[model samples]
Target: MEQRKEITMSRLQRFLVVSLIAVFVATLAPAALAESYKFGASKPGGSWYPIGTVLQRLADKNYGDKVTVEIGGGTGNLLNVMSGKLSFGLASATSIQEALKGAKMFKGKVAQAKKVRVAAVLYPNYLFWLVWAKSDVTSYQQLKGKKVNVMPKRFSFQALNQQMLGALGIEYKDFSKVNYLGFNDAVAQMKDNHIDAYLGPGEENYAPIVQLATHAPIRILSFSKEDVAKMKAANPGVVPFTLDKTNYKQKNDVNTVQTFLLIITNEDVPAERVYKLTKTIYDNLGDFAGAVKAFERVKVANATGDMGAPRHAGMDQYLKEKGLLK
Candidate 1:
C-alpha cells in the first residue's frame, strides 16, 4: 500500500508539470504567431471611419485579431503610412499624386512619399461645396469673400479645397475667415450661420450634408466646366462628377469634381501579408458592400487603377494568381 501511494503521488506531480507547460505554451502561442497591424482610418463623423471599421472586422476575424483600426485622414494617412506609423490607410488618387510630386498639398515630402504604396483602389469621392439656399452666393467664385470651413489642417479635403480654389485664382487669404473643422463641427457651424460656406468630399447623400439639409435648406454649389478643366489640368486625378437631385433636395444635378479613393500601405509590409489581405477583401466584397454602401461600386478589376503610387508586390501576386494581372 505504501509503494502504491508513492507511485500515485509521482504520477500526479508529472501530470501537473505537463499541464503547466501546456498552459504556458497556449498563453504565448497566439501572441507569438499573430501578425499585428495598425490600420489608420478617417476621423469621427466621416464615412471612412465606418468603412475602416468594416475592414477591421473582416481582417481581425479572418487574420485572427491581427489588425487594429485608428483614426486618420487622407493626407495624414499617406504621411503616416510613409512614416511607417500605420500599416495601411485610406487615401485619394489626387492626394497620392500630390504627395508623389511634392506639389500642392504635399509641398516638400517627395522622398518620404516614395515610402507609401497603393494597396487597392476603393471608390470615388465627390467634392461638396455647400451653402444655405437663402444665401446669395451662387457660384464658386462668389466664395472669395465668404467664411469657409475647409476641414482640419492636413485633411485631404482641405488640400483639395485649396487646389480647386487656386485653380480659380482664389486663395485662403481671400476668404473673410477660414475655419478648420471636421465634418460634424463644420456642419454645425454652417447651420448656426457662423460660416458662409463649407467644403469637403464624400459619396452621394453624405450624412453630414444630409443632416444639415434636414435642419435648414442647403444648396450644393456647382463647378463650371472651365473651372473643372483648369483643376484637371493641374491635378490629373481630378474627374468631373455629378450629384443628382436624388442625392440631395436640389433643383438639378450638381456638377463637381471627384477623386478615386485608395488604400495606401507602407512599403515594408510583407508581400505575402498584402496578398492575404487583398485576397480576403476580394473574396468578401459582398460583405464590404453590404456594410458600406459606397463600397458597392468596388470591383476586383478596378483595384489596380493608377493612383500615382507604386502597387505593392503582394497585391500584384494576388492579381496574378487570379489572372487579373499578367
Candidate 2:
C-alpha cells in the first residue's frame, strides 16, 4: 500500500511541473508578439515609398517580424503621429516646423511640434515649377494670369506653393485659375493642357515629370540668383540646390529652391526602437543608395545640415555613437 502511495505522489508532482511549464510558455508568448512595430511612409512611386520598403525589408530580415511599415500621404504624416494613427513617418522639415509652431497649415493655436523630432535628413527635394516648353510663361513672375496646379488640399505641396507664392508676392487668387490636384492628377492635367504650370517638390529625375518632358517639351523655371536669395530669406529652411543637367532629359542645369526630406518620429516611441531603425538605415546605407539614386546625396556628415527642427534623442545618441554628431 505504501509503494502504491509513492507512485501516486510521483505522478502528481510530474503533472504539476508540466502545468507550470505550460503556464510559463503561455505568459511569455504575448511579449514576443508585442515586439513588432509599425512605421508610416508617404505615397507610393516616390522616394519615400522605396525607402520605407527598404526599411521594412531590413527590419524583417534583421528583426524577424519585429517591425512592419505602412505608406500614406506625406502631408498627413506628422498629424498622423500626433493623432496616434502611426508610430512614425517621413515629413518635410518646413511643414513639420510650421505644424510645431501652429502656423498657417495647422488648425490649433499651438501644435505639439516638440513631440515630433528627426531621425535623419534623407535628401534635398527641389521645387520644380514645370511648364510647357512652348508656354508663354518663362519665369515664376510670368506665371501670373496663368492657370497653375499647385497640389491637392491637405498636401505638403499646397503649403509649399502658398509659402513660395507668398514670398514671390503672388497668391492663388492672383492666378487666372488655380487647380488643386494630386501628383498623378496634376501630371494628367498638365498633359491635357488644362494647366499651364505645376509647382511642387520632387527629385530632379522624377519619372512622371521626365515622361512629360519627353512627350511635350517642358521648361523648368529657373529661380534667378536674386530670387533664390529672397526665398532663402523668406523661408530660412529653403536651401540653395542645383539640379544638374544629367538629372533631366534636357542637358541643362536647373537651379531652384530645395528642402530636406526627413525621417520623423514622435517622442512617445521608445528610444531603443528609434535607435535600432536609424542604425539599420545607416548600416545598410549602400543598399538604400542602390534602391534610390537620391540616397547617394545623403551623407552622415550632412544628415542634419538642413534640418529646421531638433533631432530626436535616439537619433542623437546613435549619431554620437558613430561620431557623426559631436
Best-fitting candidate, measured by lDDT? 1
Model 2 residue pairs with clashes:
none
- The global C-alpha lDDT for each of the candidates, from Candidate 1 onward, is 0.83, 0.77
Could you give candidate 2's per-residue lDDT for residues 199-255 as a string of tens digits?
Answer: 887786676687687778888888778888887776777778887866655447888
What is the TM-score of each predicted model, taking all chains together? 0.87, 0.83
Compared to the true structure, candidate 2 yields what TM-score? Answer: 0.83
lDDT of 1 by residue, 213-272 (tens): 898888899877887899898789889988887766887888889998888887898886
lDDT of model 2 at residue 5?
96
Q: Model 2, poorest ten-residue lDDT window?
A: 64-73
Top TM-score model = 1
